[model samples]
Target: MVNNTDLTICLFPKALSIPSGFVTLGICIGNVFVIVSVYSIRSLRKPCYIILASMALVDVLTGIFGFVAGLLFALHGRFFYFGDTVGWLLHKVMVSTIALSLLHHLLLAGDRYFAIMYPYMYIIKVHNRSVMLTLIATWTIVILGLIVILSPYYSKDVQNVLEYTFMILVSTQMYAFHLRIYCKAKKTAGQVSSSTCQAVQNNRSDFKAARITSIILGAFSICILPSLIHSIVIETQGECGRCRLPFYVCSMLAYANSMLNPIVYGISNKTFSDSYKKIFQKIFQKIIRLC
Candidate 1:
């Protein structure tokens, strides 16, 4: 009567402990930094910024609470023991974090669609309450999804698989948007310096955000999907083999979402970029004076 925890024993042999430790640390520290950066901005008080901040916070938790710390349990095997409530909470938080991220992404896509398609007209229409509603709704959606999975009818593994699948599909919508942006940028290449083109890549356009979303969704579909499938199969069959590698890879890709938002995506528009540069320049000058 072996179970999922026993599966960890199976993975311990194949996983590169050294690399996993470093990777997990990298994700935890990097995501923590991004979340902190997002909140430090008084200008980032809008709904969209809140959503991004939440996502980064969860990414940090998922990396530390879900992966890096969870791995310690695996490394210790039967040597480590913890209270039942703590263990339950850990699993619950992990599930919630992953599901919530999916919901936040959907909201982000919706936000972009409105901003680009409507622009000035939309700004006048969206009041503060509307933003609050969107933020509340994102968590509501995640909670509802978790309630479905946490139901007595389904197993934990079932919930995990469904979460991964939902992420894959919803993310595809975002990727399609990014692809459209890429095409538009290509068409206007001569006029766009590489830096200028980069800035507009995810600015406020109907095509802008959707296109950037496409890039991310596309990456998840290709790089993250196979691993998710592997995970589902292993869970359903109660068998373990070469599955851990893909599962680990997919998890990392998902966690990388936080870093991607600030780096890979074109959220750094001219306005934001200029702001970023000015702040950094002042810091650099201060540093030189101190030296």
Candidate 2:
């Protein structure tokens, strides 16, 4: 295990500035695209898009506060030095944003599952009011998670255990449920084609939605799961020196999740993708006409 002093000296600001800055920029841009695209396009407003928009909003904050703050810290070689209170606040904000994002992802999965598995009930029962309630619940859970993480009552190991266990269980169960829904939808689609072309089209659309949801979930896991495991191991071992580099890399990867989400979730949907293309084409057309 390298000492903190050695870690700081080796990862000097001059050596770290360029790469971290580039990464922060990329993440911010991707998150911004999702935010802007969703807001500008009216057709994209639906329960599913509401969940995705919530996720993108958090991702934007993550890019701005989490990655951008980290970039500044790296550039100045502050290396986790923001004064005690400020550092604590930033820590809470960063962790809470991440937790909120995970909650949004789960809500998105639930949205897709219900929409597919129970379309009629979903249409009647799930609406803007329900979306608002879901958002409130998401924030409430994030707040509680932050409180537990910040509280001194629980040992760090205990906190890590709780967080990891909750995340793993929720994520695994959500994915499994989504997989079941997708399979059932697929089977139904295969059996119902003879009934009507409309039924087949509806089934196809459901399959597409499920496929996109699964892709987003897969991307999220790829980006965040490593950091989660690393955090658990570090907290359990109570030694961060050897884990510092890996943890930092994992953190960057986790931040990258925010960047990938908009592209994966937003652009994958036909409505959002079409809207994005139209907006860009209009801009280019105006430029050509001016020329």
What 10-residue stretch in candidate 2 is worst by lDDT? 1-10
Global Cα RMSD, each model: 6.1, 4.6
lDDT (10s digit) by residue, model 2, range 73-127: 7555564444334554566678688778877878878887887788778879999
Please give the CA lDDT of all the candidate structures: 0.56, 0.70
What's the TM-score of every candidate structure?
A: 0.64, 0.81
lDDT of 1 at 86: 44
Q: Return the clash pairs for model 2, or none.
A: none
Predicted candidate 1 versus true structure: per-residue lDDT over 60-95, tens digit per residue? 666677463445556554211122334444555666
- Per TM-score, the best of the predicted structures is 2
Residue 19 lDDT, candidate 1, scale 0-100: 53
